[model samples]
Target: MEKKYPRLQIAKYVAADYFSAMVSWILFYTFRKKIIVAPLYDSVGQDLNDPTLIMGIVIIPLFWLLIYYLSGEYHNIYKKSRLQELGRTIFITTLGVIIIFFILILDDTIISYKNYYQSFLFLWGVHFSLTYLPRLIFTTRTIHKLHNHIIGFPTLIIGSDEQALQLYNDLQKKPKSAGNQIVGFVTINGGPKTPLSNHIPHLGNLNNLIETINNQKIEEVIIAIEPSEREKIQQILTKTKATNVMIKAIPDLLNILSGSVKMSSLFGVPLIELSHELMPAWQENVKRVMDVVLSSVALVVLSPFLLVLAIGVKLSSKGPVIYSHERVGRFGKLFNIYKFRSMYTDAEINGPALSSKNDPRVTPFGRMMRKMRFDELPQFYNVLKGDMSIVGPRPERQYYIQQIVDKAPYYLLLFKVRPGITSWGQVKFGYAENVEEMIERLNYDIIYLENMSIYIDLKIMIYTIKTIMEASGK
Candidate 1:
């Protein structure tokens, strides 16, 4: 069965990053060889070789990667915003070129000082243009897909009153090009005295938000509570503040008119402000492409280990080696998540149960596998299938999600994006032993969501690797 939070296609994203870097480097080299130096002196046109030339080509990309990571460019590859991404790309490219000029190109055998500035300009133009062009193309295609409904993030509305209904109606009337597609509404109070009940499914009360999000596969949550419920709103926000979902506030019409809203649109009806959607359309596309490429490579490279795990599972347990179970994904959709079975055939015969560190039902091999997260390898298939990501908030089961939402209404926010095989929470908190523990870890995930960036993802990845090497995950 397919998981609701399908893993991201990591291969595409890795390929994009690799190719873009290669192309940018090549362009820089060509410009230096064929344009800048060649035009300056006839003798210089002949073959000129520097030992560091090749190294510079290779090293430049390493620098770019470092800068990109520092700039938080790699996180959430699927949800980038084009404008912001372009701005970042330009900044990084310019910085890279300036550094290159002083380190590699400035002290060149130039006859005139004018040549120094010319060379710098040439390198910067070629590198930035080549790098950003491919990124733009890839991102544009993704935005198109989102608008065409070929791809959509599952969204949830957080309020049940008149304001919530107003926001829902406004979003529904928006042009198809709007990126979001609302799945359903989770009421904040007992039952909203609003028109939304007739238009959309009232998934459940606020107390069951996490459960509703898991069951419905929600991706984004729009908080449209009334102004009077400030205290209650804060409580809801506190609960949801931990997940990676997009949280947008429904501002009053005056706020919209006064330009306090960052993003808003008129859909032949009243206007609404979409407060948070951090990345640009293009960056999001680039991120997806990277995910697909990396995941594909990982699957191939780790095939041998996967085979061994399957064999081990077969020998260690009586049931099938691979276990598929329901999981909540982006937009509250349900999908079957794949994993190497880590427990006995009927480990949970009583019902859904959280595994303890020394659970008796676990197979001997399963214990080792859980420690190293080997049981999660098969999830790469989910990434390939576009149900999850390599990095994001980890998906949860409906049972525990309901439990979490009872105490934290904001747990519903996690439904805004695809779940991940590894997340900020997983890297920091590992596995949760119970509902309370899960809620505790939810803080890290929420922080990740609000401060999502490529740099943060790399840090998490590095930490995750460290955890795995030490067998620190529980």
Candidate 2:
């Protein structure tokens, strides 16, 4: 029975912040007039009706809102941890105050340098208090509801054994609810109904795990399999890799010592929370912004070059100037990936095949374009269209993807991110001539997935540039 008004909660937080930001700016304006300016000039010079005061009242809150949005402050408002939020608020408050001071308050007329410190401290204190107090109130109410079992996440248990039953009982016996409202249990062993069936309905076996998760609107999953069934844990994790639900499992001493798990509660069952997030929220936002901006700029700056490439492609072969093929993208969604055509018309008439170094399907100009990676220039459009990034794992045809998945099930993990025009895989392993080589290249892609960041992406782009300069792509 968790309160599911996420939009409503977000609105509350936004409204609270907007109101508080306006109040803080007004109070700071008044303080500057009364304490700083009045003493120096023997007058409260700026009245409430001043244009600057009105402007601050109008625009300052919006400025703060932009900062909050970019910092990812509004994400998962219902699940916010008060202690974590306190730290985040303080940090962001300090950052915003510094920015505002330099941009808005630094050049103020004052009696001494001490006035600058006074204005900064006063504005920061008021803004932080006004902003954080309302947030604390909202978050505290949500936490109170969760702890009291008035609200909870729809949870599923992913095992059927003595261990699963014990874990279920432990959560039930907790003095304060950890917000996991166990909806049911899914059997892993496919055995007859066990003691767990006495407490909760058996949803199904692993064959329909994802279907069951979707059908039940599951928000959380706990893998509570017995020690004897630990080998099946990888199968369970792989099945749930594409799901958005939060996944947790009972941790062992090895997990604890290896620092693979994070503790969310002091009294609740300790478990290893499996996060599907490849990058932090703010970084993801920034990456998308960079993708759009850089792609837009590249398209504009390279328009003439792109035109020449299009002409070359049209003349080199009877095929279309731009080749568009359906490629699997983020979350297994299909999108037509664009590239300057580098092969003869009907190049894959024999079947979808990976190009080799001396492939006859490649046109003479196309071979040069591939060497210099001019063939990939058109994918900047894909990046702008949101189907890809400038840097990520290269997208593959579903035919090749199926073959890759058969060899390495974890290859599906690559679908978690947008395909890129240039990738660490392409940079490190170059073009794959066959499925075996594609599997060989997947290791670097997996490494990139595990270590995704704006920094890592920039590094991959640098390496890719070097490969293109050396004409190393095949």
Candidate 3:
């Protein structure tokens, strides 16, 4: 079984980093005080009793910890590759040293400019050495445990053919276990029992894929179906959209040449690791920070405008100032999305419906608000509430989501990310008046998902601003 305490492993690394940072800072301070300052000024003491030392001791370690967190060092601690981690440590350590030099060290009194260079190099070397040694030891211990089968991730094979059998055999026969404890196999097509059944139990098929993943606590999924069965591959991926499992598949020559596949283990069979996560961890965290900050500012800055709009809505039509509706969010969770009422109170008396240009249900003030998107102002609260982001795929009500899913099953993939106040779909395609248009808009959202980053988000926001200024959302 996998270690039940992954947090303990993370804490071990964090403790290592924090301890190393404190020690490195102290060493750098001593070097500055003794070699740099005391030699030049007799009044300067070599003792570590200064307020500067006290402050550095308190702040520098926390600063380094925050950098490590943003660098995503704590994620999937057991699955980290030591070689890759070494490279990452060197790069990040150099970058952090530069930052510290400018912010904390560069202005120090020095005998010559040579001291600055020496200080930078010494800090980088000391920090890197202290940080990497303990990390290397921890990682080596985890890898040794994995190789000895002392710990393993719960893995499931999503195929039942000869390819699946061969994959199972290859992984089981590997000189070192890739930590894949092949718990069972799931069938893709209905047929006779596969050869793999002799080794592992059949969990179920695609119909109950999500249920099986949840019930079995699956951490990794390997799709062993033939590459030629592209439809099956698509189907398997679609069903696993809501799962948090790491997905890998047997790759063809084309995929390899296209650089779509990456090696997860040197000792295990070659396979393409499919990544559903769209953005890097640092950018994802930064985006959330931006969402909170921007949304908070927007709500505060636009309060008077919001009040005016609320008054207009109440006077223009008979309904509450705010409108709320349940929408499907990330991981298929349901949350109430907020908006200023843009339609009459009984606009949807017949049933739920999508608004269109010149829709009779839309009040005169509502149409103008939709064109300028003032009605969406309240959704900043949703962003602040963590139900949405400032930029992402637009959320759809479950009523219309089911309709959209009927035509395009991949729509659920959008649920992998939080819905946003404005999206590439809204920027390019504007509001969708029908399910078909929503599907059409989904192409842009899907593209946005594949290429998500802070840069892409800023680009989308720029275009969304243009749309609002031009009143072109119609």
Candidate 4:
């Protein structure tokens, strides 16, 4: 499926949905004109060719299309399930109906209150039927292709042990195809070899996993090692996390009985899907929107406050007011993060050090700025520049990050999100005075990642504000 006209495949979904919107709107308008509105006293004989009618036909469909795109309905078009598509379509269509009715049709001249409810129900029914039917047809075709072995995703197995061989054989012998066309397998530590190597070619060392993934265009990674090697799972993800490949693992009876496994494929096999995404697609997009809008407004609205702080920092210290430091961001990319100077010129001349409450390096005015959290204001520019977000695990310098990783290898997980100006860790545990303290704060950050949500972010922000107002930096 991915090999043939990949771009056109997604275009087909968009085209089908676009016409669905246009056709549904046309039917609803016709119903309103000929049945619902003609009985009204003033709305009789509404013109079908009016400028507004023509404009709406063009605009409404585009509006629906934008909504679908933002909802991420157009992504992974070939891999979608008809059942999931149906549910998503209903949800988005209902939202669309509410917006359209309020903005476009609430003021319409109607014979009675019944007309309002009737119009809404009619439009909603027409839209849902038209929209869902075509998508279901397209999705059905994709599924049929997969079952017939005409379409498959490139999958790589990450172990060569007994469990790997068992999974490989079961998948091959399954009556129905799961669409995982195995490209090859890799050994984690040259553990006891199995028939897996005889069946599929052994892709080289695990260290070369990324290169092999790119070269073979691997779409999936199935880890089938034993329970003792569970620690290796973290190492594999730390490397392959950047590849955007779907990762799954063979689950033991313990996991299945405990309801820890959420099945993704119902037919050929049962595996635990590893989804590390922090937010749903729509929420992720909205978070970026919030970051841009909020940062832009803060920079503009707080310009006076920022200017005064800049001069105060300059007079209190002999360093640039706006300090730029290189920090590791998402996917381990390094970028210069901006900050308002809160220390003397040679504060870090000896080496990188975490600040103590009474550190002499922090000038008197700098300490006050830290108390008010004013030192982080310049990072709004970083947020606007798309390098950081308003709420995420705080970023650390590479030297410090390396040390932190030594203590907590999962520290690298924080790199999954753009480092924020203030984080749940900063709010809950305050500043770290040493490596041990930083590791202690890591627990709160890990909690934030596991329970990430818009509401959680808002709560962290609220606590951060109260802390700043109280000059409560530790």
TM-score of every candidate: 0.56, 0.86, 0.88, 0.80
How many pairs collide in each candidate, listed in order?
Answer: 64, 0, 0, 0
The numbered model that scores best in lDDT is 2
CA-lDDT, candidates in order: 0.73, 0.86, 0.86, 0.83
RMSD of 3: 3.1
397-467 per-residue lDDT for model 2 (tens digits): 99998888888888877877899999988998989999999999999998998899999989988988888
Question: What value does the lDDT take at residue 142 in candidate 1?
Answer: 70
Tens digits of per-residue lDDT for model 3 on 354-425?
A: 888888988899899999999999999999999999999999988998888889998978988999999999
Global CA lDDT computed for model 3: 0.86
**lDDT for residue 205 in candidate 2, whole number 0-100:** 86
- Candidate 1: lDDT of 473? 72
Q: Candidate 1, residues 288-325: lDDT per residue as tens digits? A: 66678888998999999999999999999799999999
Candidate 2 regions with alpha-carbon error over 4 angstroms: 2-8, 39-63, 144-151, 173-176, 214-217, 252-259, 275-277
